[model samples]
Target: MSSTASTATSPLGSGAPPGTERRWLTLAVLSVSLLLVGLDTTVLNVALPTLVSELGASTSQLQWIVDSYLLMSGSLVLFCGALADRLGRKWVFMAGLALFTAASVAAAYAGSVTALVVARGAMGVGEALIMPATLAIIGHVFPQGAERTKAIGIWSAAVGVGTVIGPMVGGWLLSGFWWGSVFLINLPIGLAGLAAAAFLVPNSRAREARRLDWSGAMLSVAAVASVLWAVIEGPDRGWTSSAVLLSFAAGALLLGAFVTWQRRSAAPMLPLRIFRHRALAVGDVLILAGAFALIGTLFVVVQYLQFVLDYSAGQTGLRLGPAALALLVAGPLAGVLLPRVGLRTVAAAGLALLLASAAVLGTTSPGDGYGRVLTAMVLLGAGAGFVITSTSDAIVGSLPDRDLGVGSATNTASIQLGAATGVAVSGSLLSDHYRSALAADPHSSDLPPDLLSSAQESLGTALAVARHLPGEAGPTFADAARGAFVDGLGPAMTTGVGVTALGIVAALVFAPSRTASAPRDKDAS
Candidate 1:
């Protein structure tokens, strides 16, 4: 889609344009759609163990059930954002909601692990379209600065609210029903959202009338798909497997070609020019770093609750509430706090808090106190809330007005890609350490490989097992697993610390001066 297209106009120009009532209604409906998408993405996490038992899923398959959704959702943002602009934001957004509802119904009734994973992937595609388009609509609807800021706040709040409730809802459902109920829940909400959205949102289109960047979009999809495929499969197959090598090579080649083509094309899908603003660049990088740590933490923490604490899915969800409350407070507090201190100062403080929180998390032993874990959770949530809100504001504020949707894409894509990378890196680290530690132990001979894999996958879980195994063997395994996970956590947290430190430095040295206007064109990047 060309930059020439207008972002807002009636699909039928003569119709009454949307008013404040309609705008808020549209936001409400879109927010629900967002809530469903966000909830679906994370809710399945608490139900994974149950799903595995019921469906006879393998380690790789379980990973796919989570990862395929994330991978597709992350990869499709570039094209989807352009599609919203070219086709009509309202049209694309509603279509996504409809698709999502249908897919969720299919996911609920899935008979096998393969079917469930495929359904989740389809749901992810729906999610990719809905999110950026909704954001773009927010930008279009709330033209005034104060109103827009408030709108963004509401949008960000929806994320926190959705995240907090997702596990709790999934937990409650999984307790009485099957794991399928988590996906099943999306059906009614999606339908209501679809109905509400049709009446509320105004139609919008890109100003620049030009061809869609078909080549760029396809290349981008292939590039990201190939890379994600290799990264995901690498631990299962040996890293040097011929298929893995080919996937990696293809991903790199396609990605490089996409970048090259975008630079040369008259109407690029993902114009390289967006990277020019130092504030935007630094913000994008910092957003990725924060997401990396946060996601990696989530993956490990759930394991701790289920495996180490011996908590049921419902119990695990309930335990996460304090952290969620902390997150709820932090976004508003950070907005109040950020401008008072510079962005660099506030972000650095948050990252420092995160590093400290991770260290505290490493203190969990075979049967550690719950209070200590809860405190760590609060600190992590507070820090993450600050990081997410602050970085998001900086990225969007720094972008030129001409590319609002594209800017939104850059922000969302950075988040999705960052999350994808974090999961791969953190999961790989924990998996490798967990397996090696257990196999090296003298008593691991009787343990099945899958049992060992599950134990190796999380410290909390291993700790839980250690509490129950015959003849003190379980405790011994748990102790080994806890040690291995801590070892992995330290390095991952260290990487976060180092990256955040660099972001702080970059923000101070390279960010645009306060007096400067948002940059566009070649100078914009």
Candidate 2:
């Protein structure tokens, strides 16, 4: 295609090009869809204890309930990105919205734990389709420049808003309704997104859409699923167990094969050549690190508030509100500064702040008041706002229009992978530490072995069993369990701090000092 043809505003089936007014309207619809996706990520964290109480779900089951959705979304996101480029972005997005809406209903009405898990997996597929398309569509509507950067910042903020709102909404719902109400809330939003998307969004695709590479897609999904399975199951099953070892080995082989196939394929789904760009590679890594810290912190801390500090879901959500407010305030400001200070400085500062927040949270004691923790959460939100917005701008700005779907998908996939790993790793460490703490507690020596075993299984179980025991012994046991749980947070959050600290170095070393310049669609090369 000629550079002029590439740059020119093309007619959308209607003979006229989209106007500026229409472009922003389209963004509004896309943002709504993004908000729903963000809400789903953390909504379930607040519902875990309820799930355990209501459904008799084990600790491993609870982790799966969270990880299953992430695993599917992360695995299929890139493939869906390629599919969007081949098909039309709007078509895939609408289909995904429909599927997600339906899955939400199924999840809300699920009869058993297994049923809920299946419903969550289906939701993941829908998210994979919706997540990448939103950003790719934004990239299409906004031409590369300050306008695009600002637009991306808004888009990034929409996602941040979703994550922050998830806990609040979930907590409020749980206070008055059943745990299933959290999933049900998505229905009305998804229906509205579908209607708005149909009229406002334009259909767009790559200039030379490549043939779908089925082999590469399958290999990628298998590799991601197997690896996530290993991570999710490793702590419970024992890392040295044959099942875990085999899963790791298989994931490695499949991933290697997927890479090799992409290298040799005539029409590749993922153009590996893109990684050569420092912005794309580094931006993706930073996103991964940010998500790891973000989700893992949510997973551990929600339990801390509920099980240890004895806060209700609503109280916990309200306590977290300041962090959301901080993120909302900082998100757009980061965009305004991008042109002046560049991505590296903004992103590095964000990572540093996140590392500091993690360290503060790590020192939290079971009896501590909410003040120090709330301060740490504010820092956490600020850091997330800067990193998420700046890195997103860098990733999207650096890509050509034709590679927008691929690039957007990769960024979204990195987030899902990090979320999955964060939950798995942090959950594993906490579980191990909690069990060890329970076994070592002097107060537990007189308790029956089976009772101690039940207590060691999970905080929810420990608390539940403590309620059945009579007298001072019950209170003492409960106190020890809460202490163990709080102690576990130290190592898990410390792990997050270590990961984010590395992201700080990466942003400084690999992210460019200036924003990447996108070639105008109307300009000739």
The per-model lDDT (C-alpha) reads 0.69, 0.85
Best by TM-score: 2
Deviation of model 1 at 490, angstroms:
4.0
Each candidate structure's TM-score, on Cα atoms with residue i matched to residue i, is 0.86, 0.95
Q: Write model 1 residue lDDT over 131-221, tens digit each, in one string.
A: 7788777766654344555566566656655665677778888889888899888888988887787777877755652367889878977
lDDT per residue for candidate 2 within 93-146, as digits (tens), equals: 999889989999999999899999999999999999998888888887776677
Lowest-sum lDDT 10-residue window in model 2: 11-20
User: Positional deviation of 211 in candidate 2, in angstroms?
Assistant: 1.5
Best-matching candidate per lDDT: 2
The CA lDDT at 142 in model 2 is 76
